[model samples]
Target: MKTKLFFVLIFTTFQLLVNGQGRYYKAQMHCHTTNSDGGYSPVDLVNKYKDKGYEIMFITDHNFLTDSVYVPGVLCIPSEEITFKRHMNGFFLSKNIMPDENFTCQQAIDSVIAQGGLIQLNHYFPGPFTDDNWEVGAPEIISFQNGPHMLEIWNTGTETVQTHDDKSIWDAVLTAGKVVWGSATDDFHPSVSEALEFNKGWNMIWLDTLTKEAVYNALLNGKFYASTGVEITEYQVNDYGTYKSINISSSNANKIKFWGPGHQVLQEVNGSSASFILQSHSYVRIELINEGILGMSNTYAWTQPVFLNNPLHMADNKNDIPYIQLYPNPNYGMATIDIKSRQAGNLKLDILTLEGKFITNVANEYIDKNNYQFLFDISPMPSGFYLLKVEFNDVSKTLIFEKI
Candidate 1:
């Protein structure tokens, strides 16, 4: 019997890890049904946003793709809503993207990037029956030059009919270098009442797999976060050597601003949980707020702005770390890892493949640990994305889970 395989084979070059344990998916990318004026009927708006919890629905009906009604557990995604004068919302669609009243919003964003689809800039301020005006901003027309993956920035029907919250045209197109990523919909129209656009604005996707290519690869890699009711269960980011630490939990937020660039706030925390550091920055993003309770006027949550000089991506930030936990997290197979070590001599977890490959060794030796917990079955593995690496002495960590 010869079975000597020590294991530690992480071949390089695929790093874009940002682990904070996975599974978030509560998406609703834009709305409108009856194929246009949207009152309901595309399986009753996917059974009213999957009975209010919404796993993921990108119906986006307006110009085409023709909603082929399919709802069972929900994950729709074939979108289109292109208005030539200015208003767009196309997602991973492969065809049928009609828009041409002499089309020009960069020709409907190059006809939704030539039909492969990914456009989204809906309601860039224009609704008072549209003569177009938001103090004539958004560079006053024809200025999405190229960037286009998102920018609804809260358009619950233009903030419930023209209160307008384009997030200052998404910080004037991210101070004009144009990265584009920020969305919050519920542009729902049943004449706006499923209690005024069910859940108001949403996209909290941090995908593993509910498909539609993992929800457009988590909206093409910005991961995601954009809410209205405020619920960011836990988020952690850390990188030290000069500073950059951010943590957030969220009871319903009391305040947790830390934006950047023109939306500028840098830091402000009042706390259901917040950690804040950031010495210098290029991009930041996090704004929890929550102020409205009895009067109901303020409630937000948005995060997707982390670029302190993005050389591809690395932020799973664990430096001098230990204090890991992973439970339920969409894990139907089994998971319950808890570690709090401070001085454990040897430990090694490893298990990968969220495109990084190498998978095995759930643990190794000598854990005279300072608090540890286990149990990791993953029911015979075989689901979708995964990653978990622990290591001890020189410290290293990661979680990113998902089995169901």
Candidate 2:
């Protein structure tokens, strides 16, 4: 079944999709209140965070749901900490989830997904000085299906006692072929006067508006960076069909580092600006460190990740995919997919959501021809963005076009 077909993938940074059009808004994904085990009420927490210049927060009290409310200039969403043996958090929730007896971590993760909420494994890695042990390590985390969308890489509530960086765990998960984004939070449990677990950790989300859907989309697509203090001033990523590189600059960072799989420090710079070429590694995420501010330390910011090769995959992708182009991209009507293959094999082309959910099939055939061009009417599909997956034999590539 020969048909017009295919596309090639050129991976780029998050900024390309939203670089000049949008700005970053401060967010707190985890926090507690009197609903569970915190000192402040929902209203009080919202007011305090607004005063701190925060634009968004998910009030995650233990097993208790806080309805979405808007303070003068702040947006609060429904969230909760599923107080299980190994803790978990569900944000942007629509229902209150309660874990019953014999309920497992995978089950809890699915419970959040069932409600269309964003889930994360909270403070899984144990610090060297702490004796607390839970199934929060990568060994068990990678075993779950439909697992968390994010991980609490830096949680001040536990780091105050169990001081450890969860990046090692993040690398392990990425190495195991799982895609879990990194997140940071204050885990606020004290009053402003107590001064503990307040305004210490947060995320900067990229968007043009401050609304529930905007915030949810940013998080759902990894369009945010976890941070303690360091701020990102400028970031850009450029990738042609064959070459790719990324550059970032910040005012507060003393050192800029790019980390790869297995906690490998691929590149490090001493100054506030840095650039890295994405050539061989499967993926690399940026880290910014400012030793201290106001005689204090632990200020850092972590970008989600910029991948040369996607980690959440079935087989180790090879360098065999042919370079091709799709014209009239971000099309409203007619669009064409051209597959220029040198060797003959079975080919399959698909359109999918960025998260890899299949939307429609474009072509599937045994290709004996060198060139297959597909002209399909794209107006039938919705106007949102999606991915173009081209699979030729065992080698496949997902080309990320931010504007579908």
Candidate 3:
């Protein structure tokens, strides 16, 4: 019914230290209010979702910010749906913003970033009768090079009308190695009694506290799963030395399907829950399907892909430790390594091939705390992808970069 907007990327490491800190919470990150086109007021909308068992909700009124609004039992995140040629939901905004009369997709995205908000590209798939349906590709918001933080893989509103399935678009971005994540939204505008569109979709966020900051951190770390109806009790991925494996448990799921890079089904298991040896792939996510339930059909649960980064040989570094960033990423031999170390140590920087073969010990020096930058030249090596490893004492981190 509306134009397209953008979000998605998985840039964090997968080392979660679940030392009994976070708990799972139900969240409806996107929804409208009477502030825009929805029937309920902000307070009523929050109360409605709270009654439906949602612990967190974002108002996301079109062109308006609900920053001053609060609901007694639910967390009200300051968000707004920026309506333009394409529509996008900007979350965790420092302040509210309205779209320009002729706002382009990129401009909207830049606006969100300017305000330190995480943006989700809204529904890209429109119904057949809609002006911007699937036949007309979403060119303005398509590229993953500087795309939004996430994409709506399954939208309840779209599902209600039986149009705009975006699995194909999601797979294309994943195949291109963009490191994006998927989200399912209610996009609710009708009354809760209208079960077909109102509480049909949601995000199950894994966090320790029921605070806005906690939710933001979890989302940033890709620590949540999306569902239309099915409930995921547990989802885990562990490396058992030589091989990795994944285990999943869901409520009433008829089947669990594991997908690889190219929309390929790597494995499928029957029943409500199952586990499998993790296959070799750039990314992996599970799709749970169930028969009709609660006047809704084709129940589904989608997990964010487990993006693999090289593991640390020891325990994960404390959360407070600073991370390193490699810039001039696709450089012609010369590059910069920016370090913001929390602790001082003897630093050993080296380059290695993807096969674990040693390339060269680029730098070995005693480094201080705080911010530091080091430059390395790989002019002697051929153009290709390689790992840049920074080791300090017993802790080490690795980053993949390309030489052009």
Candidate 4:
């Protein structure tokens, strides 16, 4: 009886650990097909992602959803990438919303929302010179739009451009205290021969089951993480009175990072791999640093930050923390501010317009005991760039914000 009881206890503990670790599955949420502007057909792209061990694929064409394709062992989600002049992609779209080059960016967002589709600001920051030109020409037009469900924080094919622009757009939306998620896509336009390799930009999503409903619902609830190469070993959220702590662990990774607009590196311990304890800062990210010979890195841009408000300050501190970790200059409207230490203490958060007008002030609140987070509120302020100043523990950090 004693021996049997010992075995049972050990087995139960093992099961609990396995359950706590969570599961990771490789998937590709963004791809193209001949149905729109891509070179490959839906069937071919599905085969490609499957061949790459991707359990799921979302074929987002330039303005159309291909007829559903049923394949064994792989899930193909019918979706479209509404290709406006600025380009916004929607996954799990009810129907195709064609892009009109003549329509403004806001109009495009509205159209996608109307279609019962989740909208993502697709590669809006950097792309060809034409894209950059479009953004500059319509800075106000683009900045005026506020709420979006998600943003393509990274695209493997456009890594160079994505790295810079994603941060910019994320910071902008975060500063506004909006609930926005981040996603990664292959955005592949593969040739017939390359169809097998088309899903190289696949992101691994962690879900409870392998069903279309489960995957889509997980994404909507921000239950998954995105990745190109590295896989997440563990992720969870721990809520404290004044701050939320996000703990993440990865496998075969050289570095793990938590980056967004207002990024504050809480704890970075380097080893065969690394471990970090990030103070919740209103962003979703799980990155694995590549220690490969070529120094190439694999990143996982997962769900957005889930905000847990402190009931004591819910009314006064209603704004979610801003994404305050990007550049340019003279932010007049909203901005991100990073706080580095985790020790809980009185923190004074302030924002001022570039022209020297005081915008907001929140005083004497406890921060994370180990890590700090960014804070911004600009709902009442007028348009223009501004400066963000955070005062805590006799230390001051400031950043720039632009208002449109």
Candidate 5:
């Protein structure tokens, strides 16, 4: 009897250890409701996320906040996506304060700060307006430098063209020596797509407890991991600033990645897992590959890298890098390209057929660098799919566009 009791105790302790270490909980941070432009009401949206195994959901409707609702086994936090000329998200805000369009980005920051809420700059790189003429200008670079407590380094449904800009923003912020954290968001808006089951973007925050105040505190303190589809089983930053590692375990992951602005590679044959070493201070990201239908594959996990020391500092762009913007995607006939920089040089814009053949060179010029918009005449080209390649200052981006 003594031996049997001892064996039972050991087994119980082993089970508890397994459960305590490297546990994963899926969640979606940036979601919308009918209070803004979403299809479902706040309650319905919460239920949908919960049913999808999300442990937490932030109801960040445009310029509106919902009351905190506590549900069993899930958390429904009161939050809002403050939609000014630019957008920002404030989570766990006071029940009394409400966001409005009239509030400047700084004012919104101040409001959230007053309530001890956690603030994050949502999609700061490309700026949210989709019109060629709609120039909101980059989030007051100073506010980005000084205001927000955190920034969303990844947003689901964000096009590949804008991803370069996102990288640039993160690099700048990291080099500046700021005290900001990184986040991933779904930016879920039902009107954008007909599929109702597409709630996949979220940040997995590490907290000691499952309470609202505890979670918010953890996020503010930079204790979290963001994910698109993959989940992290273990993440650790050691005493050496030069080394960090992540271990991931998932049900349907084909390939795991440790990619970012560094010279890192995956070590295969390590028990069918992916691993890498950190070299630079840039945001490190992990990607999970998935097979899609119709010759269209999907890369699910889009996580931003966690910096080791002073992850908040912004980098310098002494070259006055030119900013490019494309608008009205899924276009009908013509589309616009907007450029902004401190100086201008030779520019070349090419449209390539989806079949990897050259279609046309739309715009080529030696223009001065300032805010300017140029329209590409696509009426002459056969439609279906094409890529817009823009080259300037030896840096370029190929923007995918659909002609209808």
Candidate 6:
């Protein structure tokens, strides 16, 4: 029995993380072959990975799906890197897809889903120059309804050169109320002899049975952790509806950090194992690090974020989601604003563009007991993404709504 790497997990998170029966399979989720721009052929690449101790691998050639190889012990899953205006990897795809420039990003996502595959956004961090205005920009990439949900958090091919990690971008996407899982990959594209560019990152998937179907479902459910080097011996997340408890122990990590919204470190420890009790916030993620020598950067292992079913609010009021409701949430013409809180204070309700620019004042007054039910008219506004912000007490929270 080798080290068990648990894959993506939600409802079955604890079982996969704690069950000694499960083993974590070393996976090279993304790599290229000669079929596209890689220097190594499929056979050579598969052998190279096996030599380096990868239990499972996906040879994701750019715009091409290399034939599944038949290796004795190694698992070669069908995959491809959908290189359009933006880059994405479709894992466990049944067949290769050819998307022309005329195809929209969303269309590519739909195509992958049609094949029961996962569309993971490749290194879109600092590698490419893009902004929110660009249709394929990082911001826009996450806006697609059923779009790229798995982001390449650490790409070794681009890791040593980047000024920042993709964790910031991941945090941004979470802050915007979208759920995404992180993936680390080598994106390797070198020959077997090219030691300099070989293996620097990978995804560790945990499974009881070594099968392609099990691995695919694991990745789909986010049962794995993305790592550069640090390895976790035991990871457990216990979500108890009201509060959550997280316990983790790593063999190589010297430090563990518990992070929350906006990349805030809620707790930090100096040992290999640590526990965190999360009572509030939208979600929490774990980061394990091992310090490097001579003041150099350290290695990291990032676990998928654990979202809270119920959390405390900013103030004595209620949480941003449940307590705040707008009748006809996707309003056509007129709607009713139904909102309340336990505390009473000055209120400021404003509508702003998704870019955080002030649009107009919906209301600014003092309401007794912090209860308000009024009629809101969006018929005069154009259909777009807008923010409905409520500022009361000393803290404020904003909700994104569509005016249709």
Q: Quantify all predictions' global Cα lDDT against the true fold.
A: 0.65, 0.73, 0.68, 0.52, 0.56, 0.70
User: Residue 95's C-alpha lDDT in candidate 4?
Assistant: 48
Q: Name the candidate, 1 or 5, with the larger TM-score value.
A: 5
List where candidate 1 sits over 4 angstroms from the true fold: 1-42, 46-152, 166-181, 187-216, 223-308, 311-347, 350-360, 363-404
Q: Residue-wise lDDT of candidate 4 within 233-284, one digit each (tens)? A: 6656665546556655667566665555454433444432443333445443
Instruction: Indicate the TM-score of model 3.
Output: 0.70
Clashes of each: 1, 4, 11, 22, 18, 14
On lDDT, who's better, 1 or 4? 1
Poorest lDDT segment (10 consecutive residues) of candidate 6: 3-12
Which whole-number lDDT from 0 to 100 does residue 137 have in model 4?
21
Q: Candidate 2: lDDT of 338?
A: 48
Q: Which candidate has the top score in lDDT?
A: 2
What value does the lDDT take at residue 101 in candidate 6?
74
User: RMSDs, each prediction?
Assistant: 18.8, 9.0, 13.9, 16.4, 22.7, 14.6
Task: For candidate 6, report its TM-score.
Answer: 0.69
Quote the positional error of residue 403 for candidate 5 in Å. 56
How would you encode candidate 5's per-residue C-alpha lDDT over 1-404 as one tens digit per residue? 11010001010000001123334455677878888888788877778778878788888887688765566678877788887666778776644345464667667765664343667777665544332322223334433322476677666645322222234555454444444556766677754553522654577766556766557545654566666555555444433446655544545556666544422433322222455555554545555544346414343544444554422112123323444444444456556655544466877777776675766666677767445566765655555767767777686756556666
How well does candidate 6 score on lDDT at residue 156? 71
Candidate 5 residues lying further than 4 Å off, grouped into runs, are 1-22, 95-102, 127-146, 157-166, 241-272, 279-296, 302-304, 308-404
lDDT of 3 by residue, 59-131 (tens): 7888888786777878877889887766788887655677777776667665664343567877775565233
